[model samples]
Target: MTTSNGSSGLFISFEGIDGSGKSTQARMLAQALEQDGRDVVLTREPGGSPGAEEIRALVLQGDPDRWSAETELLLFTAARRDHLERTIRPALAAGKVVICDRFADSTRMYQGLSRGDLRAKVDALHELMIGQEPDVTLLFDMDPAAGLARAKSRATVEERFEDFGVGLQEKMRAGFLALSQEFAARFEVINAARGIEDIAADVLARIKARLP
Candidate 1:
């Protein structure tokens, strides 16, 4: 793993498809670290800050056909910019371990795989908006169909990603795997087919080994 500069605590991100158990694992990891006496903060993308939450509702509920790829990318970046400035940066600066449910990686995979030609533009925007990347990223790998099934079983209402067809979900999964290969040190792909406690334990072990 690459060494991070200064005294700022580690920034970790949990990423995956809708039903890959990212939220559950992120919380478990944070709790375990806190129990171990490490300061930790848990937050989620597109809804961490109040401003970002409002923007999240707009982006998620709006008609996808009505919004262009460029527009979608911009909206997501706007929320991320707010989240970074208001929530993530402050917590990390105080030497608190920040465990994010999702980050810029989700946007890269979803927008890049689903919208091809717009990928470069999104990448450029990401570079401009999010200056600091997470120290470690845990990607929960699972079959798209199984993920959708699990998500549906737990969800009270369907979101845009949940409404998407199987083909797009498969493409998104492939995109995440390709990204993990590209950034091997920063990205750790965990098999999420196991029970929640077992997956959380594996994630905790990785985080503990990586902590400075």
Candidate 2:
């Protein structure tokens, strides 16, 4: 899967509501791919590059209402741009499969719809700044309530979004499902309401089918 930048690399992003097990699946996939002799760069959004990591602390560690939706959108875009330039693009150019825990789609749902109707703005900014999309987006689908419970159990400092409660999780799940339809060609939906190994096996199979 060659990216838009002409890099002959497969860019896969894992996306789902908080605590949907997408992160765990992403790590497992990276390891599996590495064991297969593929050069894999496992990373995450809002914190891939050094600059992006700094921005991540600001956006993720503060109060839920620390920044308004608009402000948060700008912050996320900045972080993504830095991540693309410093980490993602370079790895792709070197012909590495980059497995990202989250990407633009998260911002599209979190900042675009979670707070208000700013999806258009998000799209516009993305086009103007970071124009690259993953070659494949794996959407881990599961019950929002269950996912929230899992997320809250983590007790991580990045609980700002989780603090918004189940309502937001429900909305994010719906928006992500809609987004899968919107970008169905590159979107692969997986049932996340299962054991880790089972889900990882399903993910690896799908990814293998897509590999060039």
Candidate 3:
């Protein structure tokens, strides 16, 4: 099931704390939609387009303290700008469903939840730079302890974010749930703890109900 953002096609985003399986679900959703004969573009952030990908590596690799919260905020916002311009907007214009693994919400949860209540800054940047929101955002809600365990099992440089540990994962989950309330019009709180097949099926059913 896909939700149209009142544009040419649907813009769907999967959001959750790391290891919530949103990434895998994003891939599955894309494949399922394609099998259904729908034109779909599956992508992700803090990278999606070429330029944004470069930024992605910069932000995701290296020491955990590589960049300050404010600096990381700028980098993420820039990446999102490029992604929207080069990938998401065009796909939508072509009338193809665009499923992003993560989007601006990650920035909000990661940076906004950081010290000093930086959410306002994140929101300001989003409002000023990337003004578009997804048609439907599937929030993969689950236990932080389980999610952190899953994240720790990965052997990738992208560990920068996930390495923050389980405590933060709990906070991130809460933040995502709060975001669902803020953008209730387009947010679907999916139980990520369920079996992958069951979660995917639920997501499909929900999205199909919103397809134009």
Q: lDDT per prediction?
A: 0.84, 0.94, 0.89
Among these predicted structures, which one has the highest lDDT? Answer: 2
Off by over 4 Å in 3: 1-6
Candidate 1 lowest-lDDT run of ten = 1-10
Cα error, residue 74 of model 3, in Å, equals 0.4
Candidate with top TM-score is 2
lDDT of 1: 0.84
Per model, state how many residue pairs clash.
0, 0, 3
TM-score of each: 0.94, 0.98, 0.96
Ranking by TM-score: 2, 3, 1
Off by over 4 Å in 1: 1-6
